[model samples]
Target: MEIELKPINIIFIAFCNNPKCKNTISIDVEEDTPKDDEITITCEECGNSIRISYEVDTI
Candidate 1:
């Protein structure tokens, strides 16, 4: 049996905007994958939510 693995190069980090609790949000995505226009991350400490938006322009 043979197995192959590829390096993980798709990672992004985001911090919660809640001043009371600033937590790290880690997101993993596949290569060449179309991402969502917006993302929401919740803070584990303070139970706060933060939203991240994305914009794309096709040329």
Candidate 2:
């Protein structure tokens, strides 16, 4: 039997509005597939929830 694999290409970046809280998160997903539609990011420091859509490249 033979098998093939595909490279995973997914990049993520987090941006916070609060200047006092310097929290910028970045994540890279290295899997066989990319993200479907959107990605969610949660802030550990401020407890903030941010939903990022695939359409929006810049955050």
Candidate 3:
């Protein structure tokens, strides 16, 4: 048996944890697959750090 794989595009939305900032960021994932379950990013507006985590379940 063989499996075919293709590139996937995903949109990840995250918001800054800072109560005063509350900046929202949209991340576009393309060209390659994510290697980690967590993504860390900094807010451009307030320079606040944010982390986005996701869980994968197999069927």
Candidate 4:
């Protein structure tokens, strides 16, 4: 017997906190999700981390 799983969709928004480096970064869920329901991404320019929430929907 084999089991199948459904796919989940999520969106992510990243932004820098530093006043000098106010860069923006965005990404979409592709293969898998983060370790927890919440994700934290760091800014490449200023090394600032931003926390984001993830949500899944079923159709």
* Model 2 clashes, total count: 0
Residue pairs in steric clash, candidate 1?
none
How many clashes in each candidate? 0, 0, 0, 0
Better of 2 and 4 by lDDT: 4
> Best by lDDT, which number?
3
| Model 4, runs deviating above 4 Å | 1-11, 34-36
lDDT by residue (1-59, candidate 1, tens digit) is 87775444456688877777668887666545554467666777777777767543433
| RMSD to true structure for each model, in Å | 7.3, 6.1, 2.7, 4.1
Q: TM-score: which is higher, 2 or 3?
A: 3
Q: How would the candidate models be sorted by TM-score, starting from the highest?
A: 3, 4, 2, 1
Write down the lDDT of every candidate, Cα atoms only.
0.65, 0.67, 0.73, 0.71
Q: Write the per-residue lDDT of candidate 4 for residues 1-59, one digit (tens) a residue.
A: 97777675655777777888979977676656643577778788778878877656544
**Clashing residue pairs for model 3:** none
Candidates 1 and 2 compared by lDDT, better number: 2
Residue pairs with backbone overlap in model 2:
none
Candidate 1: regions farther than 4 A off: 1-10, 30-36, 55-59
lDDT of 2 by residue, 10-59 (tens): 77888865666779877665564344576767877787777877642332
User: What TM-score would each prediction reach against the true structure?
Assistant: 0.52, 0.57, 0.66, 0.61
